[model samples]
Target: MDTLTTTKPLATYVVRHADDNLVLGQRLSEYISWAPELEEDLAIANLALDHIGVAHHLYDYAAEVEDDGRDADGFAFLRDERQFTNVQLVERPNTDFAHIMARQFFVDAYQVPLWDALARSADERLAGIAAKAAKEARYHLRHSRMWVLRLGDGTEESHRRMQAAIDELWRFTGELFEADDLTDELAAAGIGVDPATLEAPWRRTVLATLAEATLDEPHETVMRTGGRRGLHTEALGHLLAEMQFLQRAYPGLEW
Candidate 1:
């Protein structure tokens, strides 16, 4: 676990977003050489770099916000799963190709609007970071959106699998817009985008894509919670173990 815990609103907000990018970046990197096609492998690798690159920028900004002398490496490598503030959606495992694309599409859909909103933020640094991330997110959404259309409208088997992936992952979507007290305060101050306000647009984007892909909107189900507060599925622990192994094994080791 990290030694310094911060409660400053901007740093908290920045760390949460940084965690989102970093966790999703790590998850995408798992497909490094494993994508189904050569072109896709390269594309996914680039997308992973884009996400990790944003994470590095966000973490650096977070360290600046906290002003506790900890840097980007400290936040990215020193924190435990319980200290991570990412949404659970990003932490989900790559169960299969259908599941992978489904998950990516969902997050990409949310993040596109999110970064777009933040690009107009009161905090200039965050807005700068969001401006860059917004471009990458648009491309990420396009890539995932194309795959979703192909898989969902392709064959009976592909459609069935894609639908199944959507259904299973639906339970985790609610948390995307669940804003906490701190988040609400930050939103009011214009330092953060209130996730609650993004839901309507996100719904429009997602539902339209689902419709085009001939996929059904999932029925409302019990949604998972607590990722922002550090409660997580067992999956994050295993992931953190692997992700943090090098830094943990050799403290202060640098490339």
Candidate 2:
């Protein structure tokens, strides 16, 4: 017997991360056909696929803990947006290339530490999943960081766009490090990593990357909150509606 503690509490943790990626992946997929050019459209589509792939992988792990026969597809397609636990950061629309990179960079930085830590989770299954996913997160961060560096140091226009995106998106980031009741529950069960511990390494990685990119880290501000407790931006409900539309309208529907 594995004799490992349950990953049920860890489901709360995994769902938050996976749901965020799933929602964001859906948003990016929306932009695929509308990109300025075929090449750009293809690039957008590729990124969308990558995000969705990760989302599905995480969801599968979450479903494993459900023990109610709900698989990844069931969990993903069946839930309403309001019921989703993804952060507000992932729900934001992809405004531009810079905007997309900015969002990805912020999440990817935190994800690296998170998944790396989860690789050793007391829950055996989660630890295995984390070990595999951490590598994917690493590649994701690398891709986003390279784009950030290029855009920040490229032409004047690119720099302006990148900087604007950074400022606009930075406010939502505070939620990533915010610990709450659910976090407390999971942490108590040895299934979750402490958000506070993630902050230092996250800061180090982010600052070092921004400095190398020749971009000035914006001044620390008051910071924004919500998302973990389901208090999300206005955009999330609409997104959930679309994402869950088919599932809601046609229960038990499958491809």
Candidate 3:
């Protein structure tokens, strides 16, 4: 198996994970004042903060590995769209409450297992970050899972919306488990977990949740990909434009 046994690939791998959390966190933050209820708004804000905090640590570690003079903020706010390696799933727009819940459910299911396995990594810092992140991922999963169940089983309109969200988001999920040379090499060196290993567990949890909610499992479809390779949907570019605007407008300004 090809491996990412070099410094660059390792840094890239770490940064990709950071990018995933950062982008998704930003998306979730958009719901802070827009959530269905005041309590829900606070809940979503806290969840977004959780992801952003994890991203900060991961990006810091990646910067240290890369030794590129850039810091966590640079990686998070200054990079161009092509520089991001997060899977396309996290970058898609949150169209509605149902769409947001479905996206969170899919991502949290994958993240729970990914972080759990990474918590045992041979690299000490990576392991430490994973250990912390695994805890947050568990909470994220629980929150998202409950919302999925509520939306999927609640009212006729909610059920229809939840199913639509599931169908629309399902295609992007394949990238979560798609292994590439970077992962193969990192896994071989005990620096990273092969994402493919998390797939079975993710499916089981997602399927069980859907079943209990009375939601149908979406039929397998041709998966849209490329974010792992620095290619992404137009949506990501727009997301970045907004996210990076502050930094771009004021190159080195600080509060």
Candidate 4:
């Protein structure tokens, strides 16, 4: 089946995941140099690598239908913030280790379900990619869950920090479950998962994990958005400036 004529279902899923991972990966990369500890530096770098690896697989699929001849690297390093289609949460700053762990806990937990749903997509290519990414996401979730438990159940300060992080990040969590036109069309065609359907299960998983970690759920409230449509925060502009510096300065230069 020609995906282009079929509303480009699989391609949208791959590209969405890829764009989210790439943007988040770029944000995490910034911490490599600023992390308070060397172990943390390595861990952030590893996480960034994992996200970029998943992105490579996703973007490769997207490139097949891309009008331009650009490949994954080109798609990754070349795009400006306005061109990105990631969720707003990914671009949020890592305020502290506890906050970082909290955010990762939410994202990684959500990633597991997202990939698992895609693994059963009507699109075979997307299912194959999701199968591969699901394995990686599983581990990522475990790592994040462990940190959440430790921080949440640790000393008074650690517990307070973990709870505060969760409160600060809750607003962003709503966007993960928010779907758009592309998702609606794809879900109807059975080529994509409805992010809305995953909300209850996702919330259950999060609540369970947080309970195990001794974390409390804050009252649900207004959620922030805009990354899905390429509108990002001021911080994203700074991030893009750094990530796209070499690309913008020397356009068409690639090793």
Where is the poorest 10-residue window by lDDT in model 3?
1-10
1 against 4, candidate with superior lDDT: 1
Tell me how candidate 3 scores on lDDT.
0.91
RMSD of each: 1.5, 4.7, 2.8, 3.6
Count steric clashes of candidate 3: 2
Q: What lDDT score is found at residue 194 in candidate 3?
A: 94
What is the total number of backbone clashes in candidate 2? 0
Worst 10 residues of 4 by lDDT: 1-10
lDDT of model number 4: 0.81
Question: Clash totals for all models, in order?
Answer: 0, 0, 2, 0
Deviation in Å, model 4, residue 151 alpha carbon: 0.7
**CA lDDT, every prediction?**
0.90, 0.79, 0.91, 0.81
Kindly list the per-residue Cα lDDT of model 1 for residues 1-255, writing each as its tens digit: 542247687898898889888998999898788888999999888988998999999999899989999999999898877899888998999888888899999999999999999999999999999998999899999999999999999999999999999998888889999999878998899989989988998899889999999999999889999888888888888888989999999999988
Give the alpha carbon lDDT tens digit for every residue of 20-88 in model 2. Answer: 778878887877777656976776677677678877887888777767788888778766545677778
